[model samples]
Target: MPPKSAHHALQLEHERERDATQGFEPKGTFGFIRYLEHGFPSSLVRWHYHDEYELHLTLESSGKVFVGDYIGQFAPGHLVLTGPRVPHNWVSIDTPEEGVELRDMVIQFAHAPLETLAGVIPEVKSILPLLHRALHGIEFFNISAQAHERFMRIRDSTGLPRFIEFLTLLGELARSSDYQLLSTIPMQSTDDDAALARISSAINFIVQNYASQFSMKELAQQLDMPERMFSRFFRSATGNSFTDFVNRLRVNKACELLMETERYVTNICYDAGFNNVANFNRRFLELKGMTPKAFRQQAQGRFGA
Candidate 1:
């Protein structure tokens, strides 16, 4: 498994509701794609996931990048494409006294429209392989400048021109070999929509409440599912047992604190929902391959702190 999965459930729920009520894609939009940009420390900067494939470009600042179970550093021009419902966030560690003006530029689009197009458009089908690979998130290298330029074109245009630029960019990315898959365990879901919805709800709950104690029994009850059945369903959907998933989320939380704060290891352990220092140390090492203190020391070097 990758180190951890991260999300903010309340914010994710809010985004879902907002999109449902107000709509994210424009009424007159020709394609499913939407372009968005936000600065550091903004409301958009949260650990959350949505039902769109996102091409994320870091325009300013460097810090921790969380994609599904993967945790690592990101600087300017760092580009990643994440699939639908993959929890992700980027926290800036080296912000100035005055925060950055524009920290991230993103393009989000749905999978269905493109898949539908590919039925008749042979060339459009080439990107499907790349889309499949993005189920685990892809970090692209050596093409940041081209990505930035193409993103600008896609953002500034509308209708067919924008769609053309979007395909052009995806084609470039699809053809490029300089990329790495971030998540070790791919997030594959069963065809049952109800089961997927339940899993999504459960994941949101875990993201919001990972700092506190919770039980699979309670969650299963809330979802009106049998404990054993839910256990099988969850592991099938997320590639980890319920308890293991939550623990990894907590470990990822610990990683964030270690990289971004000066709190003591014991305090961070508890803050990350670990009950005791010894267990925290062990789990941290098991997932991150380092003790908490050592992790913090190395993370600090990222900021020269």
Candidate 2:
């Protein structure tokens, strides 16, 4: 029989599937960037996307952050800027001992608003480059400390004070050169419609079949391309080899199961699409910087379990 963790993971998977089908629409009443401060393990903790630029600051805890096709680790004070319509989520690796009350400070604004404003406001144009770079997602590795302060001020202030602080933060980020683009390939534009469709189809297939063993040859066949040609295109589009991309997805699934279920590590290993425990452990450690057992222990500690 399948392990209990398998059933639990399946249920969570269904929830995420539903979320994706229904879509998440951010509601902003002020016609500007909306500010939100929320704790961990909330409904907002899911894989979803919206048509707005997102500036996210992790206030506490560490986890793996998924933005576009990029997968990486994140800790408290981690800051990221995601472009419009980019799919993203941050999964905390471990819960806090005292319980986390606030895990993220977020601000969401539309691209049109910023672009329109930039046309009339000469100073606003200075930050346009930063926004452009966000098409692939941007990680401000060294600006977390400074960014956190600005995020806090934006969170605590009201009215014009908050608005001004947000603009100031953007200006600061624009001037900073310590940021890195998270995604290997930038989102395709109108001119690359054909390429966009091809890559999108490939991504969808991967997301749907990540838990099963498959070959690049089979994927190429499905896309009606020769294996070598498809491989080159895939690598160019995702900035990752086919094997690396699959492993990253599997590792990410393992992480979610580790935190959300009480199943054995061995069960999680297979359920997450790894053929064996040893390989799963190796990959998990490489990506997460810890063993599966250690991750679970840390997560359990946060919940006082």
Candidate 3:
């Protein structure tokens, strides 16, 4: 469990989700940047989405970062870009073997840099599609050895020069050939402003109840929609049926528990909400291309947990 003070601070941060008055109209030149240096023993979801495009640069860390439909290992020199309303989170479970740390910088920008208003501008139009692709997620490697210095410069500078330089680097990144799209599914329209609210609500439901046994019946009722309509809406919005989507979360959680805990595979399966050990094994193999034991062995070889 988190320490008392940290627990309260985290709760306060989580409560921000309850305020649904804010609209999803993309705002520009309004990104907030911050530095994060996390040591260990952290198990908080903070699984919220926003209108801002998030750029998180992992300085020196090895953990799993779940971005939209993607879940994989996150290591040093990794920079991930996620677009608006793509629910993501980083969970840090302490290692029982020696020392480990997770450190990174997160810059959340208002909407994407390319807006419909900028469609008329020839230059802006060139980069619009790339930015649109980010709605799913993007991951890049900081191959430039001087990246630390460049990051420091961006962090310390204050004013238009800094902002311009920042945009320039991002432009270079958007145009670069060395990035991977994390989610293959094209982002769907939540329709309009109300779509954002619905997406937010769905994410809230997932994060708050991932550990428990949840059914679409409850969610459909809560959203005040017919079961069929809610099911269709969810599949269209997330690119996965409700069952598959929740299974992804379960498998992701199982991966973390497998590596971080000495708990048996059967126990881990039960804890992650798997109905049976056999099913868990099958799904784990399907998604990870390995059985739970094999995955744990691999992670231990690399992370030595």
Candidate 4:
């Protein structure tokens, strides 16, 4: 028999081979977005990427989600928008013996047509920023009820009506503030060039210094803006309060540590910039719906570990 290390290496190689680029071409489709649904354990449930933005909604089962290099948990009502060619997969761990009948509902559309339309159609221009953010991956919260309804409408209709409903869905997602960027680095900006520059600077600083102690007041002073005003501006641009943003960065860092290292939870808490283990556990549970240890255990399933 092969050694354990050799077996694991072979397993990883096999999984990488499964991570092929899925090709899609719209055939007889009325509009840009194509709607698709499939059951758990189907051919669609693989680590893959394609040249279209995918708005994916998980309707059943709980699992670990992999987007780019981010690994996290996912459950019902989990809605994530992934940009073109950003690798992603959801491996359901809680499937029943017979498997789920319908686990995922998805809509995909290309970027070029949307960009072209935005050049002429003022209203459609609003979705540009959302598309840009999806380059990392955006997991929206609290809109699953509405999203499910819209997906059903898109699936049931044909031609222009379906296209209109799809637009409505895009508009809703673009406007929503309750979301988190999942992979790479979380970045947010506004239309104002000046504001975008300032926010970009602040985001860069935060991303670099997240492991150290810092304050919004200190950052505000550095920017020569009043604390209260800076606080509001930061929220407007990033969709998260300054403190919440820092905490999320720390939590995501902790997730990476838990997934990649064998270190103790206490050490990881401080390493991820949390001053205390209790607060680390609380924040992890609040943002992830699971404790740090639970998250680590579930993340292992992402690799078939």
Candidate 5:
């Protein structure tokens, strides 16, 4: 058998591989709340989802923020609230500085604790609507410099002080009117068990096998339902047709690859499960409002690639 160090290294490698393939992971400390500070070009900067609700403040950077299917610009003083299990990432524009540190301040907490507290203190429920809006992710705009200072204070404090500061921040955000919903579609959650199960299965299958050619008939059969019935149910549950959902996933993957790699557009289209270039270009333009080449160029210009 290998040494203990070798075994630990192997375990770390396996965990990383799992994270690369399966995007969902638990983040931060396993407590009521967790605080994290990160610099640019860190390993934590990636496209991944977590079960915690994240209150993120940009400290020193300007770049694009991707939440679910929405992508937009972000800069210093940009604040966002992301709900549980929403895929999100922030890519900073490249800078000339060699060793910049601490570009973001992040706070994450579980929903259950807040919900429990709200049950006891009704006043806390005022933020419930804001939490609901975070299901699609919320970007707070025109945030004042004082609000940014509060975020820094939250990061600097500990224990109950940190918790109180966080609650105060939430109260202010809940009352503020300057914000935008980033995602067009909300992450579906339903009380109907059957509908939830069916939709979850369908989404998981697509995420796991997005590179393959999707057949609606085959998917319906796999779900043990007729094609027409499955189509209706999918639309009702997701607010998107089966074809549109698949196309959006493919387009999203294409966008990631376009920004992250130097692959040819045609090759990226095929790799993203599109059969041909023309359809890919058409769908890309329709979804992203730009050609793949133009998108890449724009991203390159922003990142100084």
Candidate 6:
């Protein structure tokens, strides 16, 4: 047997109550609601996805957002609408957000169950382009700028009215031509519980501790598998060595820091898990398409950060 097929225990339907409530209504007018007051650590939740769609209106803080092969950084005032099963997490726990205090309202729609919204709302006609583009992961340009004026109003309203206001925004999202897909390959999800369990555990460990020094032996031992075999499986599944994945993660974090802060290059190099300045500069340039300084200057100039 091929390791005796495994399965995923996490069913999004169970968690639908929390995401559907609080303006992210699922299943119509009467549904449960869940509100959260979490921050960076909360962003480290994991790499799992459910059937519900997630919409985030982030007001403060900056971090790298991941969805399958798409890797991009985000800043305050970002409005992101993601389809189901897009495994994502933002990595930025050290920096404190300024202005507006890093508040974000994440609404999850059990639209998976309703699955017929597009058929019902013909206003969503214009959204087909956006939805098709979203197969890769759609990002609205200057989400903060394009949607800010209305967001201020949405922030103040609550209850059913809030739901309507949110729906209007969704219509805008559907019609938005100012969007881009971060990548093309949809993230992998096997119905096997065993495979998902191991992958999730590995992803969680890497996300939380990638900045620190650790070894595959240490990690494999923790996972209760032989080191070599574990490394083989991990690389095969993710398309890269474990170390390479961690390094890519580190580089992604460095990009976010470069785009969002005034921190010095050397300080950022160390902070992003590189012990040598030369290596940091080289790797950052190799992966980000520009030297660290150039990248920062360009991002800052564009955002006026």
Best by TM-score: 1
Which one is best on lDDT? 1
Which pairs clash in the backbone of model 1?
A: none
RMSD of 3: 7.6
* Candidate 4 per-residue lDDT over residues 235-283, each given as its tens digit: 7766678988888889988998999799999999999999988999999
TM-score of each: 0.66, 0.61, 0.63, 0.58, 0.58, 0.64
In model 1, which regions exceed 4 Å deviation?
Answer: 1-52, 58-78, 84-129, 141-145, 157-164, 171-183, 188-193
Which stretch of 10 consecutive residues in model 2 shows the poorest summed lDDT?
6-15
Q: Rank the candidates by lDDT, best first.
A: 1, 4, 2, 5, 3, 6
For TM-score, candidate 2 versus 4, the one ahead is 2
Total clashing residue pairs per candidate? 0, 0, 0, 0, 0, 8
Q: Which whole-number lDDT from 0 to 100 does residue 230 have in model 2?
A: 91
Worst 10 residues of 4 by lDDT: 6-15
CA lDDT of 30 in candidate 6? 42
**Candidate 2's TM-score:** 0.61
Better of 2 and 3 by lDDT: 2
Residue 32 shift from truth in candidate 5, angstroms:
10
Candidate 1, residues 178-261, lDDT tens digits: the string is 999987676644445566567767876776688887789988988888999999988887788898888788998888888878
Q: Scored by CA lDDT, what does every candidate get?
A: 0.81, 0.76, 0.65, 0.79, 0.76, 0.62
Clashing pairs in 4: none
User: What range of 10 consecutive residues in model 3 has the weakest lDDT sum?
Assistant: 1-10
Write one digit per residue (lDDT tens) for candidate 6, span 1-305. 01212221222334443353333334544442222324444422344565556666666677667665556776676667666666655555436544233456565555432336557877655555555455456677655565665555555656776666666766777766677776445454556667666766675577667678778888888878899998997775565688777777788788778876779999998888888899888888777788999988898889876
Task: List RMSD in Å for every model shown.
Answer: 6.2, 8.9, 7.6, 12.8, 9.1, 6.7
